[model samples]
Target chain A: MTFKKFWVMAYRDLLRNRRRTVITFVAIALGLTLVIFMNGLITGMLDGMLRDTIRLDTGHIQIRAESYEVVKTSLLWRDLIDNADELAARAAAMPEVAAVSPILWASGVLGTASESTSVRVSGIDPASALFDPIREGLRAGEFLSGNGRGQILIGQRLADELGVGVGDRINLAVGNPDGVPQEGQFTIVGLINTGFPGIDNANVFLSLAQAQSITGSGNRASTVRIMLHDINDTDKVVAALQTPGLTVMGWRQLNEFIMTTMETGTAVYSILYAIIFLVVAVIIANTLLMAVFERTREIGILAALGMKGRQIMTMFLFEATILGLIGSLFGIILGAIVVYYFSINGIYFGDLGDVAGSLAFGTSLYTTLVPANLFLMAFWMLVVIVTVSLYPAWYAARLEPIEALHAL
Target chain B: MAAIELEHATKIYTIGEVETRALDGVSLTIEEGEFTALVGPSGSGKTTMLQLMGCLDKPNSGTVKINGQDVTRLNANQRADLRREKIGFIFQFFALVPVLSAYENVELPLLLNGVGAKERKERATALLEAVGLADRMDHRPDQMSGGEQQRVAIARALAPRPLLVLADEPTANLDTANGEQAMDIMARLNKETGTAFIFATHDQRVVAYAQRIVKMRDGRLVDGNANGSAK
Candidate 1:
């Protein structure tokens, strides 16, 4: 039969039972829509978390000593980056490098009149772009103006625990030049809230020079955090900055847990899509089977008219293709609308509170509509729908002309 | 050459252990352009003979031939190809594809034969006009009366200009007037196109219109001009 004739016949057969066809199409459309929306939401959440983490904590790449250990017990200056000014200038000179900030990290305790808490003291250049989050998050007072004037910036959670606010005096104790414990009195100049539970509860910022002075490490830092023009250039920049005694790490390598979770979430989402499409397949298969039974006499008539078995099968498959195309078209439109709305407004999860924690860093969830994923899902749905219709098509093809004509 | 020849054809229907012979050692030959009717009571095997002749069913222990070619050895697809090119069928209930218009139903066989668009259009239009459905060409089966639907089926059967048409109870559902009208169209088309037609039916009205009658009783041909004289 001519291709046009086959399609015409297939379309008319679907119209024989309009209600069932419409219902099956709706099932496929709604299933695809759910898949698209879920993928968009999860993708947006991961993107947001990665961007926030890169911007706030890990930069795009960090260069540290080869033997650097995160859990350092002693205040040894041997593992610190030497000639930090020269290395920072070298990193900043690369075309792909955006900004690099040298930081001296020390384990210290902050004591006030009421409470004392052990904190991770991050000494930063308050003027550099690396401190942009702290600058943006200033709740009260002013940020540190110069290198070492006895000024400090504390997170809101830490301030709350210490019962101190801006302008309150907090005593910081660390190792001095003699490798002996020494105390330095500093006034809290700023109280900042980054909203990330992990950062807000543990980090206290000071100037790099002041931290070096307090830890007796003159002109040295633990690491030089390098930001790139684009996060995608992380590996290239890391390869370029591979020095003799320095270990360069990308943000993904530093945050292994987040990357693992993102991969797991993606795999789980794919399985979810498979299950949803499987349900769609069952619905389409059942509808076509019922159609085959209802059209037994018609199939017999076609057979008697000298239609081949493969032609009969092709007719039914064509019906499924039409239904799948229409349904997936509508599904993409619907999913785009929903995802666009959520992308603009975001879903508020005030009840989630700290559930955002370090991963999401916020209570409101947004969605991103990835067009390629939507297109792929629609294509897969079409393939699956056509495949699922094969069983019923085969049944129709195998119908005996004489027996089917005699079917009551 | 005969349009169709069935030699010692036998068909048995087995229902779990009870076997009944539907056609028993029946031999028949239908010439081209002959308007023949196979007339009998129920279970007389007239329909089975028609099915065998139409290449729709295979005989158990006999050879069936179409236009001097033995078709008993033809596979299902080859048989279907032969049918498409050499035979047509009109069912009892007018079995029109209900979704298709009268024109499309007539054009279906031509389409199946891979006829080109221009020739297919010309042939289908001419046949629909011949069947006197030129004005009702755009109407579907549900929109047409019983006689009109049967007339469309007649045009469809003749679209490919096959050598033979097997119509099983072609007018069983129509009233007397409609039945006579349908039979008149078939007879006229047979005479005009020289396409042989065989009718399997118990309707006397249909039998009276045939140029020759073959009668069967209890799965065997008993008497008729095609065999011998009336028993």
Candidate 2:
């Protein structure tokens, strides 16, 4: 009951200065809104990057020869998986596996008579569902066939850069498994525009059989890339595919750089959030201090009426709690609306796509709504507001009744 | 037993390098049920004397007793507890909490004392009716006239059933009629409740309502009977 009266007093006191109260509320709301929006945008951008990398490049998990080194593009027979088809079939039999394909990776150069550029060549089973995104992205020509000879599928960006089109012939030179340079003339049977600059800028795909024949690595593959029904099932599938001479890796291991960057980004954004909260906290503290100054005589009356110092402080803290709760509620609503809009129609980064091509970031970035983050932000905002209000509350509580009553 | 006792209490105020004796070796006693006034000129220490007696401040040299318990040695919180349980105050400014209605202002002390809800409402309503503010119970201080606010303050002071009520120039801001109306209400309530009243004022009309008047000059009691007419 005493608490009820204190709450009543606090609530009415806020109403006494409606304009100031509204202004303080706006400060807290805007501060929290900005934090939530930034959190959503950053989380979306990073998660989108990771998703794109996994979809277009890493898959959920990969099984490769134990001696294989991806950076070296080692085409040595000893470094390649000899029973690649058998391993792929084994993985495809698992219920957790969404798609399984034996892929051959090689470093090569594509020439169009006027220009030549380095590219990563992917030899894939065109029938595998794991390449569905690439198949769906076929811009001008049909997708590759399993038995097509001397045919390749290149990103529209790569074709545009090389001044080539579908059905155009391009010369590809690669090192065979015997360390001999092999050259072949292949037709760009299809062009793909996946909207991912990393893939569009430097990747070319061909049938796995033809790739093995050209590289003189018969029945061999660089790795068996497996896509899971759910990314969480990567560990289960990997455990089921643990063979003696193979190394199984999950997407997290393949994309360790992105994961590390995300962790570091979280720490940096936490400091940014702290700075934002501090700014809001100072505004709240200043507002309560002004209220304390204005209510000096009233405080004296309350003290003379037998309210202890701590009780007086509790009243002010209650005021802050009310302000914080309502303000943050509005902030969460506004922030969620903004984030949802951006999540649907992403924010466009036209040139940044090309700049961040190596990171597999798309041209447009979307937001992800994490309910926990929104609530956490609101909770911390309330905590900061109440914590900072302590100084003004303490000042009011320590006032001497006689001196305060004498104040004008 | 005396409602309040001050024995050779002295209070000094210091500012910068200067010192002023606000109260000097003053001793006084007021028994329960006495209506008294401390009359003096400006800076003559009437407010200081009332502050010491009210437990708002501790004297620099002497002891103040409220309900025969030594209050000068008590800490701030202890003094607040004593004030809440044993005393009440009315200010010259009609110090009703501006945000609260008259009824709420009167009920604030009772709420602080943790009185039950039903009893709190009954006592607050009865007191407001007694002060002739039964219709003005819903009016905030800003919405009411000075006289009405003062009457509200009076009701609030007596709401706690305190041993004494201290009023400092209770009518300083009211007109002649409002002042007399406030004084009549306070006099009637004092007689009816049998609660001690100590007011620090220079108004002759207000002093006339006091059953015993103690005069002060330069922080010293001028009356030969330091105990006042209560003796």
Candidate 3:
């Protein structure tokens, strides 16, 4: 028989049990919707975390001394990058390089009149692009403006613990970059709150010149941070900046814990989605199997009327294809709507108590719909639906006409 | 050449170590354009004989032929092709595809034969009108009465104009009036189309309409002679 006849026959068979077909269709659509929606939310969350981490903590790439075993802010000048200024200037001249920041760091104690706490003081250039996020996050006083003025920026969390506000005097003590212990009293110029409590609780920022003066490390910083026009260019830029005595690292390696967590989470999410898909496939298979069994007599009539086994099988497969197409179309549309809504109006996790701080990213979780993912999912579900239908189709095709005609 | 010839045909049904013969070494020949009826009570193998003649079953140790071509040696698909090209079938319950209209059901055989749309339409329409159901062309089986559905089945059986048509208890489900009406249509179709028909039935009214009657009892033909005149 022609394919058109087969289609008409298969469609009529589907209409025979309209309620069952509708229920199975809804199962497939809802399964696919959950996959799409969950994948979008997780992708958006991971991408947002990576972007914010690169923005607030690690740049696209960083260069440090080869001898530096651990990344800690210590005032010991032995492991400092002595020619950081020259290196930063050369890197800044590269076309692919966006901005470079030279940072001097010291493990220190920030002391108020009645309290003191251990802290890591990061020294930065106020006007550089690297400090733009923090500059925007200045909640109280102004950021450090010049090279010589004694000023410091403390996180709002740290300031709260120290019971100090803007313009208050705080004393800092650290081992000098020359290997001698030194102390400095500076005015707290600004308070910073970047929403990430991990950074806010223990971080203090000062101008590079003032940090070097207090640490007694002349013309040297601990690291030179590089931001590129695109983070995907990390490998190329890292290769270009491969100096003999300097170690270059990308954000992925620097934030290995976060990256590993994201990967594991994604894998787990996919397995869960696959389980749900499998359940939907089972439902479809069961429905088709029941249909074949119920229509044994009809199949016998067709076979006795001269339909080949292949033709009978084709008819059943065509029915499954139609069902899959309808379910997947609805799935894509509904999933896209939900994803788009979440993308615009993010889900807030702030009420869950420093959720961003724990995750080391923003608190609001948005969803992003990747069109390729939607298409791939639709294709996969269709393949699965048709593949699972083969068993029932084959069963129908192999049925003996005489026996089937006598079946109840 | 005979339209159908069954020589020493045997069919056995087995259920859990119990074997019973349904057709036992029965030999019969049906010529072209013959209106024959295989009449018997239950367990008389009338239905089994019709099934064998329709290419629906293989005889255990005997040969069956249609149009001078041996069908006993053909495999399943080959037999199905032969059935498609050379044989038609009608069932007791008027097994019309419940989803299809009367027209499409009649058009089914021609479609299977790869007939073009224009010819298919003309042939199906003529056959439905011949069966006196032209006005009910678009109605599904449920929308029609038992007699009308059976007439559609008759039109479908004759649509391909096969060398032979096998119908098993074709009017068993119809009332007396509908049964007589169906018999009248089949008899007229046989006369007009010159297509041979062999039906297995116990209904006396149906047996009376057949031009030839062969009676069987307990898996064996009791009367080998054909009464060519209607009773």
DockQ for all models: 0.62, 0.82, 0.56
Q: What TM-score would every model get versus the actual structure?
A: 0.89, 0.90, 0.84
Candidate 1 TM-score over all chains jointly: 0.89
Ranking by DockQ: 2, 1, 3
TM-score of chain A of 3: 0.85
Q: In CAPRI terms, where does candidate 2 land?
A: high
lDDT of 2 by residue, A131-245 (tens): 9888877888888887768899999889989999988999999889888989999999999877677678888998988888888889899999988889998888888889998
The clash count for each model shown is 0, 0, 1
Give model 1's DockQ, 2 decimals: 0.62
Model 3 regions more than 4 Å off: A60-100, A105-121, A135-145, A148-193, A197-204, A214-217, A220-261, A353-356, A359-362, B68-70, B226-231
Q: Which portions of model 2 show Cα errors greater than 4 Å?
A: A65-79, A90-97, A107-119, A135-145, A151-204, A229-248, A350-362
Residue A208's lDDT in candidate 3: 94
What is the lDDT, from 0 to 100, of the residue A265 in candidate 3?
96
Candidate 3's displacement at residue A67, Å, is 9.2
Model 1, C-alpha of A54: deviation from truth (Å): 0.8
Q: TM-score (0 to 1) for chain A, all models? A: 0.87, 0.89, 0.85
Tell me the spans in candidate 1 whose CA falls farther than 4 Å from its real position.
Answer: A63-80, A87-99, A106-120, A135-145, A148-193, A228-256, A355-361, B224-231
> Model 3, range A63-118, lDDT digits (tens) per residue?
88887654566556567899999989989999999999898888889998899999
